[model samples]
Target: MSNVLLLFDKMGQRDIVTWNTMITQLVKTGDVDLAYKMFVEMPERNVRSWTAMISGFVQCGKPKEAISLFTKMEETCLKPNEVTVVAILAACADSGFLDLGSKIHESSDNNGFTRNTHICNTLIDMYIKCGCLEAALDVFEGMKEQTVVTYSAMIQGLAIHGQGEKSLKLFFEMIQTGMKPNGITFIGLLNACSHMGLTNEGLGFFTTMTNDYEIVPAIEHYGCMVDLFSRAGLLHEAHDFIKEMPIKPNAAIWGALLGGCKVHKNIEMAEVAMRHLQELDPFNDGYYVVLANIYSEAKRWEDAARVRKLMKNRGLNKTRAWSSIAVKGMVHEFVAGDDSHSLSMEIFEKWNELLVQMRLKGYVPNTSVILLDVDEMEKEKFLSRHSEKLALAFGLINTRPGETIRIFKNLRVCEDCHASFKLISEIVGREIVVRDRNRFHCFKNGTCSCSDYW
Candidate 1:
């Protein structure tokens, strides 16, 4: 490391390649801060130098800084190349800056970067991450030069956005185009089938993965299959699949089955999955929570309470749920009835107003999903104070008259919250999109795009 630094300092004249090599070395050695300092100190900067710095920042989990630097580079008359554009788009995607990503997409053609496959793939990924599946599809359709990477990007994007039919269509299209599907391609297809609950198709594809493509299923592939069968209420088949897995099942596999069991109220399977999960992850409270929910659904009050007691004894507490909304290019996060904000009183008042409107629209809270042993009124109050409601109230207060609100949650949106959002969408006469951990829920006119299936 010292030798490389000495060589870099001793160089009489530095070119773009020399600076790039030094920066790459520094980034590789985890000296991102020093590399960024050197980047600013350089008298002359080129596309490669800027790209290297941006990529380094992204690698170091500083995507916002990388994006800011990219903007600065553009302002300084340094015309971005294809590589630079791809790096910047990746930074935007990682940071969830959809508006900035759209601006980058508009500049691609004029900057002569549209023809590059890597840049196109990055653009597709950015649009997908921003929850703009239509834009992603448009970009995919316009790619005159499609490679395996391009096809995989489209497949993954479609799967992620819950457009399973379109994802499968593109899978067949890739085959017709004479491109062989790879491991990633199959993973995307399987995930799409899983999300769509296409059991037979998912099973057939899982078999084809090894028989036709000669590709061994990885743990993730198997996990998707487990999720597929378990989600379809085929608890026995899911159990057998996990038992017969080529690779030993991990916590993710058990977790998937446990989640399904909770949904189906399968106490037996939930117990089985929980046992394996406990062995795999002794300290994680997720398995315990799922088991408790299953017990609660089955009216096994003692068992449910026992699980909670075990969690407390093990010094494990439930993670505080949080939700976030993007407003004026800034993200605001809130916990359940969070009063720590400077405008807490205003937010609380707006929340009360929303509750009144929702109740007037005949919105009744579904308190069955709340596993806590609380009275009915307390449960209703707790449901109202959920993190999603807080974030939604914040969005309502901050956004203008006609703007749509988009929120993201770290966990599944509760049943009561989902109903409330439906009413909120109708009451405010605005479109609301909430991306939870599982899937996207677009609420408009008192209805969700998924028809409440999710």
Candidate 2:
């Protein structure tokens, strides 16, 4: 490190590529702050230096900082190249700065970077990550030439947005274009089929990927297949599929099967899945939580209690759930009844109002998930203090009337919270889009797009 700093001191008339190499080395070594300092200290900065710094910021989880730097670069009369635009647009997408992303798109065209396939592919990925599927499709269609990367990005975007049919169509088009699909392409296609419950299609794709495309299924591909068969109520087939996997099933594969078992209320299969899950991840609270829920659903209180005791004996505890909302360009995260925020009083009052409105609208608290030894009223309090509701209330308080609210949760949307979001959407006359760990839930008028299947 000192030798590199000494080299920097002795540098004379270094060009853009020289500075870029230094910046890339620093960024790759996880010295983003130092890299930014070098970027500011450079006497003759170019597009490569700017792009390297911006990519560093994005990689280091400082997307907002990357945006600020990009804006500074623009103000300094430096024309951003295709690489710069792609890196900055990725920052915008990751930060959920949709308006800023749009500006970047416009700027790309204004600066003649829009025609670059690399930039266009990045744009497509950005729009998809921002949940603007229509905009993604628009960018895709507007492209003069599409490459394999383009197809993969669009298909991934569509699959993630729950547009499975569109994703499959594009996959076929990619094949028709005579572009060989890579491993990522197969993963996206299989995931689309899984999300849409296309079991036969997914199975065929899995086979074709191996036999026809010579692409061996990785653990992720097998995980998607497990999810597909499991979600389709083919418990036995799903179990057998896992057994037949070339690679040994990992926690994710078994976890997918366990989730499906919970959905289908298959105690036998759930137990089988749990055995594998426990062996793979004995300390994961998710396994204990899911097994407990299964026992609860089956009215096996003793079994549920035994699992809880096992968790306690192993010194394992449930993770505190949290939710976050982006409001006024700031993300506000909340835990269950967290009172540490500066505006806690106001947030609490708004939450009470929301509770009243939801109750009046026939919202009933789902107390079954609160497995603690508590009374009905206590369970009700726990349900009301859930992190999702708190974050939703915060969004409602900060945003203008009728504006949509988007919240992200770290875990699955509990049954009670799902119902609450539906009621909150109707009571406030606003749309609430909650992205849970597994899927997206768009609630409006007391109805969820997933129809409570998730």
Candidate 3:
């Protein structure tokens, strides 16, 4: 940090590019506060200066602030170029600011900026994150030229939307264009396969990614393979794949296996995954919760208790799940049982009514996921208060008929909630796209894109 400041001091007269570079370096080094200071102190600020600050804010988990800066930049004389457009689009995507993203898309589409492939790619990504898969496809198809990034983003967006076959077709099209699939491209391909439970196809892609493209697998690629095998109920092969990884397996690999263990009720392998997880990521409280949940699902009461006790001993606490839904340009956030929103009473009442309708439609709450040995009625009420349900209720009451409801969650949607969303979609006669931690689940007519496999 001091070296950066010292180098800046040595410059006789700093140009806009020099100031932008130093500020960008500061942001890259996790000195966002210092970068902001430099941004404020710069004598002449260009589009890059504003862009560096906006991207810095986005990368530092302040998407709203980044959007605010972009808004302020609009009043300036300097029009945003491709780099600036991409940076602001990222903020819009992360913030679930669909309206704002569209506005930026409109702005970029003018002034010949959309001709830049990076801007087009960012547009596709923004539409995807906003739960507008159709718009994402339009951007992908309308691009006059596509780079690996353009194809990679489209592939990943399709995979997340559970359009695995489409992603695979696009991957081949990308290859036919003579654009070699890089590690990210293969990650997208593997992810598409994993979500669809195509274990053999995933393996074939992994082999081709290495042997044909000569692209060495990174930890992310390895993690995708682990997820692929694990999601297919191939616990033994997933474990073996981790064992044979050229690089040492990270916590993600073990975490993927743990998730599989949860799905398959493989307590024995869950324990093995937990052992590595605790050693590699001791501070991560989520792993302990997963282990405890696995034990709880298996009816191993003592084991579940032991894991919770271990968490307590290690001074770890399970973080409450949080979720948010953006309606019309405003974001509504909720935690479990927090009735703090202005429309709290309305949301709760609507939730109660929806629960009744769900019950009438033969929707029974899957209480096994509760992990707490409570009465069935109590478990039902508790499950009803999950953040995803609250967001769903809000969307159901607020959105117009036949409009899609998109909810973003910080945690993985529980199985109980997953089932509820499937039914909820059918009951409301609306499509619901839930973007949880790992992937997107599009629920329509009582079925999910994941097919209840997740």
Evaluation by lDDT, superior candidate among 2 and 3:
3
Candidate 3: segments with Cα more than 4 A from true spot: 3-22, 40-46, 75-78
Residue 243 lDDT (model 1): 90
Q: What tens digits encode model 3's per-residue C-alpha lDDT throughout 261-293?
A: 988889999999999998999989999998898
**Where is model 1 poorest over a 10-residue stretch in terms of lDDT?**
445-454
RMSD of 2: 3.5
Cα TM-score of candidate 1: 0.87
| Index of the highest-lDDT prediction | 3
Score residue 300 of candidate 3 by CA lDDT. 88
Indicate the worst ten consecutive residues by lDDT in candidate 2.
445-454
- In model 3, the clashing pairs are none
- In model 3, what is the error at residue 86, expressed in angstroms? 0.8
TM-score of 3: 0.94
Rank list by TM-score: 3, 1, 2
| Local accuracy by lDDT, each model | 0.84, 0.84, 0.89
In candidate 1, which residue pairs get closer than 3 Å at backbone N, Cα or C atoms, i.e. clash? none
lDDT per residue, candidate 2, 1-454, as tens digits?
7698789779877777778888999999999988988888887887788889999999999988998888889898998877788888889777666667888899778888888888899899877766667789999999999988899888877776667888999999989989999989988898788778889999899999999989877899989899989888998999999888878889999999999998888999999998888889999998898989899878798998999999999889988788877776666788876879888888779988888877887877789878766799998888778898888878888889998787777888888888888888888899887777786677889888665655
C-alpha lDDT of candidate 2 relative to the true structure: 0.84
**Better candidate by TM-score, 2 or 3:** 3
